[model samples]
Structure formats: structure tokens, C-alpha cells
Target: MTKMNHKILLGAAITLASLQQASAVPFAPSDARSMGMGGTGVSSAEVASTVQFNPALLATTREDDHFGLKIPQFSLSVADDGGFIDEAEDFDEESELDTTGQGRTNVDLLSDLLDEATGPLGLEKMQQGIEELKAAQLLPNSAPIAKKTAYDNAATKLTQASEFLDTRLYSRNPSVNGEAGLVVYSGAIADDMDDLNNKALRINGGLNVAGAVPSKKFSMAVHAGAQVTFSGKVKIDPKDTDILRNYSAATSAYLLNIDALQLALTNLDENDSSTFDAVDTAQQAVDNFNYGGAGRPESEGNTAIFVDGELSPEAEDADLDSEIQMIGVAVADVGVTASRVFNIKGHDIAFGITPKLQKISIFDYTQELDSEEEFDSEDFSENQEDYSAFNIDLGAAYQFGAEKQWQAGLVIKNLIGDDYESAEYISSNGVGGAVVSISPMMRAGISHRTSWTKVAFDLDITENDPVAFEDPTQYAAIGGELNVWRIVQLRAGYRANLAGSDQDIMTAGIGISPGPVHLDIGVMANTSDIENEAGIALEFGVEF
Candidate 1:
């Protein structure tokens, strides 16, 4: 157990501990009422919830007048399976170490240490060398000549170290010596590293407003809503870039320009260059850490650049912004819906249609981050593409049971089955472009009701393909709600993904209708092995 390796491990552990929270793809209801009943309302919605769940149900409402406004909502759903927090939790502190207690470390440890000048490897290596030289001066019984040589060499090393400490490479351009510098000892993302690195993030939010005119035979409503979905990963990839290349050369120049290290690196062996040597280039070298004459290759007059003075692979690469990929989509919908109730064969049936206009915007982006800061939002939107289109939604509900308390509802959304192309960007080098497909989904549901309690079930007949790399979803759910004198209601339900990728989602909600002002809140928990998750929702609206 050498004291040195222990310090290295401690430093590495601390560096690896810096992690950003992760976001993953999640499913949440658009409105609070549906959120409460297992994200269900296809056949069981009344009040203003009818606009979103099933427009046909608007004609069957028991309330005299209808209007709704939900100002804001926040839903934090957990999906840590591929998130940064999960990997940080499972990091193996001793995985890179050998059991023999040898003084060896992964040479690539320099990459992380290089990211910070004060890191263990660089500072410790320098200090260790100084200490070893000092110890040599204390040898006993040595020749006076040998002792004098040891003392002289040690004094010279200390002097040069002091000079380098005062150099501009360290004083002014601290970033390269800071977080921007890293020479990857490991190759591209490997399997072991992939496991340690994989993690994503997803955030979603929405707002809505609606009002309805109700009658026994016919009803009409106008619903407007806007939603946004943001998804990205917390992992950074190593790539070559023009910016880093210059930085690498600059760092190399400074390390080489230091008199102490230059004495060794620039010294010529028997076969030295015809003319150039440390003494020749020493005066011309700037303390910028880039001694290679504007970072040109060695053949281009950077003969003074070798050993410690040349550019590192980490410094030569560019575009720290290209490390992470993010995708965002915003959709605003305005729909005018109308429904009519019919009596056919002693049955009460209603049919509704909604013609809506949608403005779609998508930002498909990839950036190489130079530092840990965020991407510029204004710059991101500037490169986005948006479009507007019209669509139709058709719905039908039939009442049939011993007491007509049972209802069956069917909804066909985006009946046109349209395709949308989100914003697409390709670099001049043809290396970066992400094309995503925006598609459609259709669903249906049924529910039975009584004076105080109602039970419902819903299913998505079509697979809802995700735009990003997320999984497609096709699920079925069963839920129920109990009303106490139409004052406060308790609701619970469960849903399963028929697509085979999700868990049995358990849901519960509480609603307080207190007359015209209505408030409903719901929660959903993923109980199966599919990435551990839980979600919450809230909505408050007024109806006449």
C-alpha cells in the first residue's frame, strides 16, 4: 500500500463523483382528471375533462354549464435505469486497481489528472521527484564530488520549478490546465465504460384552457393546449476538434518552455538536429504552452516540440459541444369539438368530432461541450424548423347496461395518420444529423357507472412510436373512482403495457369538486421491474 497510489485513488474517486442528474422517457397524462384514473377518462369523463378524454361524453354530462382553466402543472417522473444518478450510484471505486499493491497506475490516469493541474498525478509526480532528489543529497559516506553534484542538481531543479510556477501558461491560461485538458488513456467508449456512462434525461410540461356549451341533444366546446417534451443524455464523448487541437499545442508549449523540463527534453543526443537545440529555441518560446509554432505538425518548423512540448491528443481535438445529443419538441393544439346524443333502438349513443390545428416545432441537436456549462437556448432555437397543420379526431360513446350505467367509448385521434419531419441538421463534414419520425396513435376505452362509483378500462389499439430513441408504447388499463356526494372523490387504477416493455402501472388520485371550482390530483407508480418510476400530477379548473 504505497502512500502515492492511495492519494491517486482518492483523487480519482472525487473526480468521478461529479455527476449531473439524468432524465429518461416517461408517460404522463395530459390533464388532471385522466391522471387520477390510471391516466384514463375515455368513457368516464364529465365536466370539462370531457374535451380531452372523449368529446362525445360532453353531450351526456349532468352539469348545467361547463368551463375549465388549468393554469399550471408539474410532474416529476423517475426513470433512473439509464440516468446519470444510477451509474454514479453503481461506480466501482477499486475496479481500476490491481490487488498486488504495486506502485503502477493506469498510465491513462494522466487524462483525468491533466484535466486539473492540481490533480494528484501531475502535482504528486513533481513533488515526488523533488523529494527524491533531496533525499539523494543526504547520502552518507559518499564522495565529496558526488555529494556536491547531488546538491547542485537538486538546487537547479528547485530553481527551474520556481520559474515555471511564475509562468503565464499556469497563471493566465488556467483552463487548459483546468477542465479543458484531458488525454484519453482509454480508447473510444468500451463496454465497461459504456455501462458506467449510459444515462439520459426527459422533461415534460403542459398548459390548457377549455369551455363548453351543453344541451341534452347537442354540445360544443373549444379546447386549446400546449405541451413540450425535452430529452437528452448526461454522457460526454471524446472527439477530435479544431479548438482542442490549438489548446493542446498551447499546453505543450508551456510545459516545454519551462526551463527545468526543457533542460532534459530539449537536450540533444549524439544525433541531434543539425542546428536547433534547447538553447536556440529557449528565447523564442512564449510561455503559452504551445511551442510548436502555431500548433503546426512537427514537420512544419516545430522542431523545438518533442517529448513534453508537443501537443497531446486531448488538446488536439475540438468541439466539446459535440459530446452530448439533445432533442426537444413543442406542440400547440387548438380544437373546436361538437357532439350530439341520439336515441336508437332504445339506446343512448353520442358521436363527436374535433377539427384541430397544430403548430409543431422540433429541435434535433448535437453539441460538443467545451466546458460543463449548458447549451445556448437562443442559439438552439435559431436552428429549429416549425410547421402548422390541421387534423381531426372522431369519438363515439354508447350507453348499454341493465340500468344504462355501462358505457363504451372509442376515439380515433389524428385520423389522417400524418407524418411530420422535425428540425434536421447536418454538419458540413456529414458527421452529425438526427432524423426523427413524428407519428400517430389511436386508443379506446369502456367504463360502467353508478350514482357514487364508476369503473373504467382503456387500451391503446395502436403502438405509439416514440420520436426519439425511446421505446414504443401500447398499453391497457383498468381503474375505478368513488364519489362522496359529488364533493370529494377517490380514484385508483392499474395499467399494463401490451408492448411488453413496461411495468404494471398503479395509479391513485383525489378530487374535490366543491361546486364550480374543481381540483384533482393523481399519482402513478411503476411496480414491475421496468426502470423504477413514480409520477404525480395536479390540475385546478372552474366550471359553471
Candidate 2:
């Protein structure tokens, strides 16, 4: 093997090792034959993977199917900065966290204060503020939550505030230019965490061993495999909007007063006679929003209630959807299958089934993002859950035509429908627990084949009910392949979601089979001004 190839294989081994700790197995394991056909193996199966897609195809009886073995296979599908892979590979971005640490901020003067306000150290300050309020008989009416000490109460509230940010991520990092800057411009850890959540890149891959044995009209195949997948997304939970609005309002007013105080004393605006007037206005604004019960402005002519002035944020945005979301799924499956075919009238029809066992692991992690601790891999399992089940897949395929080259196939996976509980993902937001429904997955396809060419169409007839925090999808796909005397193959196809997803994916693949040894590769991509996504697959095996 070439040095580069050797290194790539070594890296894959290392990754599989790390992923194993998390109990993540590959989600889907596809071979070159099906990859070359745009993921259509139902009625288009030309190889042993019939064990996975349509066991029925395994019963078609192949002249050279006595034994088949796939030593190893790997696939990659990534979007959003290549799921951090590209970033890790690039040397220039290695120091990005350092460069942006605490230096690059709009409010350079308040950077230190910002850190204190939004970090572990700041909990002490918040506690002190509460104690001072109690000393002055200005304690919050909602104080003493859970009968804790002053510092504990303050810390608890602060924690809730952080969770508010965690559950309802802000849309895009707020700029320090207007009302939007209340949370982010301060260099708050909460804001930084939201930014991290938004950059959720997705990565998935796998490893496996599979093959088949054929005997005239009765054939069967058995296989085993594992996969690991990770994905991230960011959203704001509307349920927590009101609580966050209060914090944001009070915080913005306080910070604004400080800025206005500085501006009131500025020489740049000194030429203006209303500098002191602006200062008084800022002071009044701060007091009005201080959450100090039944208070009035210190200014002689100012009042807390203004008939018309800037107002606090509404209870929620027009869209109540949360602002940030992320999910990681690790699942493994092992199965044994069998199939049989019968000739009736002028058509050959086949039936197949596979019973399997699956184990799924879940992680529901929430952390003080933007902290040094967040960078440590050891902390990844702060929130995790696991589940296991047994299932079965059933498939049927029919071929009718003078030459029996026309075919139709159907398959149902997870036929019994297994429900795996997700980690309890709760904050101020409403219940969005991690429960996943391992519902039935149904697929169908039709195809026509000749000695040198094949054409096919496939589609998802029912949605693969969500097992994570993601949208449901249904797809329509069409593909074609050209073969050169079973020695070389060229393939291409297009697949799109019909369930209102912005998906327009294109696929292509090539395969070379020199007798018993075969090699194949496939590519898939969908890019737009807003998103760029792509995937590739490679498999090697021998057929006899």
C-alpha cells in the first residue's frame, strides 16, 4: 500500500477506537454495488448486500454466488466545515481559539467585566450583589429559592440563566450595535456557547463484514456491522423566551448606563450642550430596568413608567422554535437472513427476511460552553443514555417480462417498531426529551436490466420517523448504470426529498472488477449558497 493510503487506514482505525468508547456504530453500511446504483439495491441488487436492502434479491440464484466476502468498507458524509474534520486538518486555524479568546471583542474596556459577569468567577459577584440587596432591604421577591444561603440562591439563579442560554440559543451571534447586542457583545460565555452550537457539523461512517450463498431458487445471506454518527444544530426554545428577556433587559440597561456614563463625560460629544442630559437619561433607563421592586428614577422629573419608550422584548419571537439543537447517535446491529424465490405463470417472485439485534447509545450533554473544560473530551458524557432491542426486516421482489428483466421490489425494516428513550433534554424550554421512535422504514423500487445496461427508480414510501431532533424525510430517486462485460461499470443518479426538504442531491460512482477482485467508489453532493454537503464511499471485496 502507498504511504498515504496506509496513513488513512491508520487514522480510520484510531477514529473507530474513539467512537467505540461512545458505543457508536455505523448507521448504514452500503457496498460498492448499491452505492454505484444511487443507494438502490432492492430490485437492483447485483451482489450480496441483498442481506441489507432486499434479502429477497438473494434468492434470485446467481451462477457464481457460492461464496463472497467484503474484507472492509468505509463511507463519509459531512456538511458544515466538514464536521470539524477540515478544521482539524488545517494548520492555519489551529490557533483560532487562542486568537479570539478574550481579546477580540467590541467592548474591549468591559472584556474583563464581561468575563466576570458570565463566568464561574462572576457567580461570586452575583452573590455579593444579592447580599447587598438584602442588606439594603431590597431583596428580590423571588429570593431564597429552595431555602438556600444568599450565595447559593444567587448561584442557582445564575445557573438557570445559563441554562436559558443553553436551551434557547440566540440566532446568530448578537452584534454590539443595538438591542440585539444585550447578550453577546458582553463577551458572555453564554453567547459564545450559542455560537458553538450553531456550528454543529455532522459526521457519520462505518465498518462491516458480509456475504451470501446461493442454491437455485433458495438462497440466503448473513451479515454483521456497526456505525458511528454525530450531528449538531442550534435553536432557541420559545418556552424560555420570557425568562431570558428579563435577564437580557436588565443586563442591557445596566451596561448601557455604564456606557452612557462614559459618553456623558466624553470630549467628542463635549461640544453638545445635552451631554449631561443624555447621562441623566441613561441613568433613569438603568434604574427603570434594574428589577428593583416598586422603584422610581432618582431624577426629579423622571418616572419608571413611560407611556411611550423603548419596550422590553415580547414574551417570544414570532417563531417559537428553539434557536439551537444538537444530537449524536451511536447504534450497532447484527443480523442473519434467508430468502427464496418461485416461478408462477410468467413471473419470478422472491421473498426474504432478516432478524436482527440492535443496541443504541445516546448522549444528552449540556455544558458551560466556552470554558476550558468544554474542550476536554473527558466531559463529553455529562448526559448519556442507552437502549437495546430485537427486530426483523421483510422484503419482496417480482420480475415479469419475456426475459424477466423488469423488476419491482419492496422492503420494510424494523418491522416490529422499537422505541428507544432519549435522554431528558429539558431547560426552561418545554419538554423536548431525547426519546427516539425506531419506527418502521419502508422503501420501494422498480428497475429494468439488459446485458450491458440497467435503469432504475426508487423512493421512500414512508418517513423514517425521527429518532433524534431532526426533520422527517421522504425521497424520490432515479439511477442508471452501464457495464462493460462485467469488467468495468459507470453509474450516475439523482435523489430528492419530496417532504418539503431543501434537498437536491446528485450521485455518481465507478467500479472495476477484474475477475474475483473488485473495487468501487461512489460520490454524493448537494451545494447551495447557504450550505455545502457531500459524501463518498469506497468498498473492496471478492466474488466467486
What is the lDDT of every predicted structure here? 0.56, 0.54
For model 1, the run of ten residues with the poorest summed lDDT: 1-10
What residue runs in model 1 are displaced by over 4 Å at the alpha carbon? 1-29, 63-78, 88-112, 115-193, 196-198, 234-322, 343-346, 371-374, 426-438, 500-502, 528-531
Tens-digit lDDT track for model 1 on 423-445?
A: 44433233343444434446788
lDDT of 2 by residue, 20-112 (tens): 111212224556556556667777866566777787877764556676667666677765432333322331122233335644333232233
For all predicted structures, in order, the TM-scores are: 0.64, 0.63
Clashes counted in candidate 1 amount to: 24
- Best candidate, lDDT: 1
| Steric overlap count per candidate | 24, 19
RMSD per candidate (Å) reads: 11.5, 13.5
